[model samples]
Target: MKRWRHLALLLMLMTLALLALPAYLERAELQLWLLGPAWCG
Candidate 1:
């Protein structure tokens, strides 16, 4: 039972990370966009 609970928690965390990834990537892209010109030149 304890092992099952741990597995469930791990699965939930993985799911949450997958869901959050796109938003994280969008924020990263926005940051790059904001700084892109300065870096490029």
Candidate 2:
């Protein structure tokens, strides 16, 4: 039972992180786009 609870918590955190990753990447990409090619180059 204790192990199941721990696994559940880990799974929840992983799910949240996975869901958040794309949004985070999109925000980062948007910031980079705003910065422009010359700035990145």
The number of the candidate with the highest TM-score is 1
Tens digit of lDDT per residue, candidate 2, span 1-41?
A: 99999999999999999999999999999988988886968
User: TM-score of every model?
Assistant: 0.64, 0.57
Candidate 1 off by > 4 Å = 32-41
Residues 1-41, model 1: lDDT tens digits? 99999999999999999999999999999999999999998
Worst lDDT run of 10 residues, candidate 1, spans: 32-41
Candidate 1: residue pairs that collide = none
Error at 19, model 1, angstroms: 0.7
RMSD values for the candidates in order, in angstroms, are 2.2, 2.8
